[model samples]
Target: RVRLFLDVLAAVAHAHNRLILHRDLKPSNILVTAAGEVKLLDFGIAKLLHDATVPAAATEITKAAGRAFTLQYAAPEQLQDGDVTTATDVYALGVLLYVLLGGVHPTAAFTTAPLDQMRAVIEAEPKRLSDAVLLNSAGGAAAVKLKQARALRGDLDNIVARALKKAPTARYANAALLADDLRRYLNDEPVTARPDAIGYRSAKSLRRHRLGVAAGSVVVLALTVGIGAALWEANEARQQRVQAEGLIEFMLGDLRKKLQPVGRLDVLDAVGAQALAYYAAQDAGRLDADSLGRRARALHLIGEIAERRGSLDEALRVFQRAADSTAELMARYPQDGQRIFDHAQSVYWVGYMARQRGQVPDAEASFRKYQELAQQLTRLDPNKLDWRIETAYAAQNLGVVYLESSRSAQALKAFVETRDAWAGIVEARPEHGFELGNTWGWIAKAREALGEFDAALDAQRTKIDVLRKLPDADKNRIVQRHLAIAASELARLQLALGRYPLAGRAGQDAVDKFEVLVATDRANAEWLAQMTLARVILAEIQLALGERAAASASLDRVAADTVRLRSTDGTRNKWNITLLGSLLLHRLALAESPAPQRQDLEAYLATVESAVSGGKPLDAEQTRIASAVELALGDLLARDAQPAAARGHWQGAAERLQATADRGELPSMTLLAQARLRLGAKAGARSLAQRIEVSLYRHPAYAELRQRLAAAAGAAPGTP
Candidate 1:
């Protein structure tokens, strides 16, 4: 099969060299005869790149550039009507090899709908061949076996991934390069097509030299025994060394290989526990530095397992122990670069886990330590790119802490430095596009918090552009979620800038993307939550346009989904509580509209008040929702001709909004101004209102509020 794939690549190389592109290079295009000779059979859709003259039969192919392509095999650029190139053929070959090796189509998720299948081909990344093989292998003994699954995990997976890179420039330049790498793999030489991770290289080295290491150990053991009683103790020491080596080898080699393909963390947990037990049984005083290092690694793995299982407390304990062990090792081996790096990573993980658990003060202290360690590592090895990246990441995490603590200026400085550092790294290695995109997203948020709206918008657009260029794949859920968030945020900025149509379009696009994701995985609460937020944004846009019915419908769906999710989980999801609050606010708007439903308005008002009175300390988002609900209820009361009651509700809304505004939230400032204006506090209202953009008052829903504010200020109704 390897030889056949090589032959196919050679054929592709030949075609590509002659400026020919075989657009449809699937399995059907290749044939194996009875004598096992490989043949390239089809060129039906092949195009001559250098020649402008087209044959009568090839006319159809030229016309079908965008409209006619195999859905499963088409490259993203081709699907998007971009220029086709040799890389397009490389993408097709990737699909072919993936199916041949993994026994499944890459875009299997969209098989039911032709249009969706095309979209998947255009937007989604194929699963790793090893993962596909493992999934297929789960269909019982009769299913196809990937005997080479372990071997193909890293290098082969990388080669295929490079070939299938969404950006044409990122793939192998031509088929010859891919074929040469395949030949190198066949010759038992190290391939240049894998990620340069230390762990991957270490595992590969162990796999390659296992037998030789075993033989060498035997020779050393035999030679030691020949020295008789004098070396008997030395022999015992050597035996202990061998046992430790075996345990480390088993943990890093076979255990990782077995568990990685299936992502079976439970099995990994058992293996990690056993290794920790072995370390525990050893006499602490007699254990060497090497044994301590191994113990540290085992504890780190156990901590990782606990973290994956959502046992944050246990993860923290084990991770701290791992850090302490590594710190001891570092103290013993102060000049060891590897030990230093390991200790730094352990410390970083401690900080990361602390942050996840919302131990803010602890998280800040740990992250400061992490930053110090990373800075030291970078200084120790100035040319080391990985250490520099780590430093940037540490800074970024610190920035996140600052941002969450509402220290906008400090967060902006940290984010700026992190962005610049990552920009340089990305310039040096464009393959780090995903990380670059994430940095931009962080920068965008920081800029937004600093009220640099124009810069924030630019950063967001850059984030969106970077994410769009990334290959859409199941493994890239983080990237997809970020893209959705950027889009939603863009909509908000656009709305703030008074670009209603663009905001509406962006909001709708966000909703559509999240809907597709939710459809793909209905049980994913994160995606569902994002979808609910997207709907809220869409409803806001609709309300701005005075499309009350559409806004109400959108809110209704959000409310229904929130209710279902809460019921399904058998707990009150706090995010759902926030969503419910938003729904009630929007429902109040709908019920108090021109065709007012007085009963429904009162019901929604009661619900909002009941939720707020439940005695729970609300987060910033929940507080905003509660305040919006209060303002909506006040508006309803004013419209009902109960002036004194309306003033009381408005006063309460003003207090909530004022409290929220004091937290440095922009939207709350505007709402507080409106609330004060409604309560006839014109002097205070004008002072607060000066901070708000006039574009907000231009929205139809805010028109009445604007008029009242103008009236209170003793200005004409149409005056700004």
Candidate 2:
């Protein structure tokens, strides 16, 4: 097979030049033709000299060779000087020949030696093939036979040695010359490979060639023997490896999937991930495209599983394999990117998974790739709103990642770019219209964080207006989601600006919408959570208005829903809900005016702290609430003379509240003012009290607080 492959290589080279130096020769890029011809490939990277023409078909120019090829096949001068000559190709060809005939390169286990060591081996000396036979000989006649081996009969080792000369000046100048030498030896002539040649120069050449052949041949034979022995024992072990792997994965799949319920949210994912990993390893070398597709599907399944489990690393690997498989499929059918997109959403998920793992670079790469795919879809069908929407979504999420990392400036830039890109998407194209609102909502949040409240209001109002403009008949689940988001943001803005009644109205409107959705879809966890959150906000406003009974009722509703959620789900998953509900309950207790309920407020606040410390996923609102609860609890504890605990909680609350104030997001003017007053920062308190007076006097929801402030105003004119 190798002999045939070499014939093909010679033919291929001849097509380009009388002597094309295929310098970077190795087994990896060489293939055996069916007729036993050697087919050489990757000549695009090979060196072409004076005799070689640049092919008309070649499109790009790259560097010529030296040690640019594999180090193992590199000729000594080529390694040292980046030299290019036909003899360099001849040297690499010799290495290839040694490997083809011997089952290994002419070295121990075919390990790549260093350049200097390899140079020494190729240049320093050579040993005769006859010397090797003589070393292995049993008697005198066999030793004599060993001495004349290449001369009396063609020795592949001797043929290789002459071609492998380290010094280009000493080597066969081209493949044709080496082939001629081998042919002469094969015909049993007084060959130039024999040490006792007719002429002095020929005799000297033959002696060196014969010596190198003998040394290289010894290494080859040892390798051949070891390989043969291993193959002889591998038949059963190979079958067992395959069988054992199959049985184990199958058993694991059975055990792992036993308790999983049908129609479970993660059903497709859990089964798929385990199956995909099993198949990918099992079919790495699989030739059948159908089999490879199945393996890819398994990987896709695994990706789905990982996404559901929030195992971003596992999901990324799975989705990458799916992409690879699709690429392979596309190689057989160029312009088949559409076919890959037709499969499950691996591309978007890969980007999402990358972001989840905090692999920002990887996430950006995946997102760019996804955008390229989306662009293809757009070009193929410009009316494809989903494609444009997906591209915009990727950009938005990336922007969110930036925002969360405190790169607000960068995030604003990204979101603005995304908004512009999506703006061309028609408003009638409902698939993407909701995203417009969502994008604007995020832009508003960014502006709000930057203390640009007017800009924030404009951004938020644009979202609300656009969403409200949609026809009532066109309004669906997504429309509701957008409305909820916009209303929530507006509520926050109003709350920030001391328009407590307006904030309460906006928050209540969002809650009303979510409540309607929850009534229709009982199991929609997000909607349920949002409804509960709205109640908490309303309860807070009511508490400020001194509508103690209404505030208590709202708190009661939040507690009931949160307790139900916590009872059904694991505490680990429901802690955020629990914390928010508990905080509201504490606020209700504090506002009750009755002395006994104050004890209940203290207990509720303690629970909020414990929930946070236990690693629950609390949002910024919940975090603020927890801080306030701790502060109030601390103040109560301090009044009772537990100075140490009171000091710790108050100090922590003050720090957190200060951060919020710094961001200009805190909703508490009066509480913050009083907090400053208690901490003896009278100047800060007085400033905060002026802001509190705006909320108290102008916000109808805090009319009672306004009255209290008026009385306090006379008692201490500038006091918090």
Candidate 3:
């Protein structure tokens, strides 16, 4: 059964490497297959890092601190919104182990209380094992069976208690450590489990000795002289056993009160490393492959934390070492395919993180090998939504690679295929609502790229509605995302028809929502860039309303912020550059001076045109930037007397911008109409103008746009 659990732990650890959080883990979720192997099941409430919905701002409201897992097995922070680091999983695993050995829940003996209530009791003080034994002997239903609890040969009670520590920082740093302590207890070596206090241990030891003496005295009537000797020996043996239990319990308790959380807990500073090292060294020669695999997982988690903190090089090395170590362990124990699969995943993670540095080839090769290993996982018959998702994910990422390499046609195919695969996964597994939302959202983007606006809108709407159906408590970023997409789509359609105010309001809503996110944390490069672009669009529409001063203020702010964020890391932060260029172009178009402004704006516009046409995953904010830049470029060219080129640019910009249905598209369309009128194409210009009128009337941002288009239609050709 312990081996079955060890296998389950390895599988769970592998899932964690992929950023899946198993919110429910207990004895029932752990099962033994017919082949005598353990299978971990039930990710019904798991949280995936790669969600489909547009992410929202991180607020205290969305924290997953307390509420998912069973209270009897939940970590302390899992009671409140404290720090629910991965160590919480380790705590739950310990509870599972306790139940497997003792035949009853550790906290269950105390009360069938809520997690918060249990956590308070765990933190306050623990009932002594001797007292628990006394309670059991007294026929108390509230107490666990002493004989059954003693199934664990040495220091088991203290081991369980330590792992169930209320504070995450005070528990085993991770599952690996908890397992190590368990192994030590099994081996009759010293463990970290401790009593509530030394005084408690002494009192318990004395009580046990007195009990042994009393038992021994029952046989004293037959041989008075030898009875004294028998009683003394019994008391001595009892004292030795009690002292060993006390010592082991104290050691475990001390360690539990100081372990790091599952991730690279920096607060432990060097203590985490030292404590882990101590455990590793204690049974270095005795570790089986399962033990080694668990260690590798712990090391992998540490690497991830380091990577998140910007120490990429350190993370790379750590992941490399862990992968190597796990590989060797798997080679020695070929039967443990699950752990070996996990080792392959750790190597793939190292490659995935490397992609962020623009190392395309290395990342590609890594994912390719990862795909091969993950394919084998399909045959393993993983519980559900198993390793196949990893294969699909690898495909999606590879497709992103093609997109980045200027292969839009190929990129489009990959994204579509990936989207389909995800859809199938969601369909087959509807319980993973988050995954369903994400797959649907990406599919909408793909449909939009294929010029299927209605389909795209439907897809987006589906994503939003799915999120809305979820409880507000579980909505998190999805709710805000629904609103953001709604505002963006509404603005786009309204602008296409010349509804300036409606378009303006819709765009302004997106800007306002994003701005609140930006104020919380400017450190997120992506969010900062997005906030800037949103502000630029809002300003552009404001200017179109003839609010020149307000528009100028918004543009000035965008320019200032983007300029500061500009650096050599431009490729990765390309959206920042796009925002900068678009802001400059908008400023030039509305500038009091004409000559110098036109030159600067034209240069930026040319660069953006090259980039977009060359095939990039057009980020939403950057897409808006490109649209505005092209619009300004066409207007400037027409005003400067380049009629043919002006007409060509305007026609192209108008058609492309119309695809977005953005409110800004209307102004560009009007400009295109003016260019056609100048080129002596009266019928063509009127046709385009009529289409704009009809489109505006149908838009949610329609009322303001109807007036603008109606007045434009009444005006003569070539009139301002």
Best by TM-score: 1
The estimated TM-scores of all candidates read: 0.54, 0.48, 0.49
How do the residues 1-58 of candidate 2 rate in per-residue lDDT, one tens digit apiece?
A: 3345457446544633432456677777677677766677677566545424666444
What is candidate 1's lDDT per residue for 635-687, written digit by digit as tens? 77788798887787778777766655775566666677778777777777676
lDDT of 3 by residue, 1-720 (tens): 566566766666555545556766877787878997767787766655444462654322234423566666666576664555546777787667665655445555536556545655355444433334434444345434554445543476676666666555546555555665666665544565554454343433444465555566555523543544555455444334333323233223332222322222343335435534643453434554534555565566656545534445566776776777667765775545465577677768777665644455666677777777666666665643656677677666666555444334555676667667766786777655555555556556555443445675677677667756655613354355445655665455444444778778888887777766554433444455656666766776777678887888788788777765564234432533366666666676467443335566566666665655543334433454555566566667878888677766656655554534333234444444544554455676666667665432332223333343445568633322
Q: Please, what is the whole-model Cα lDDT of each candidate in the order they appear?
A: 0.69, 0.57, 0.56
Best candidate according to lDDT:
1
**Residue 299 accuracy (lDDT) in model 1:** 76
Q: Which regions of candidate 1 are displaced past 4 Å?
A: 1-362, 470-475, 518-524, 548-550, 560-580, 592-623, 629-665, 694-707, 711-717
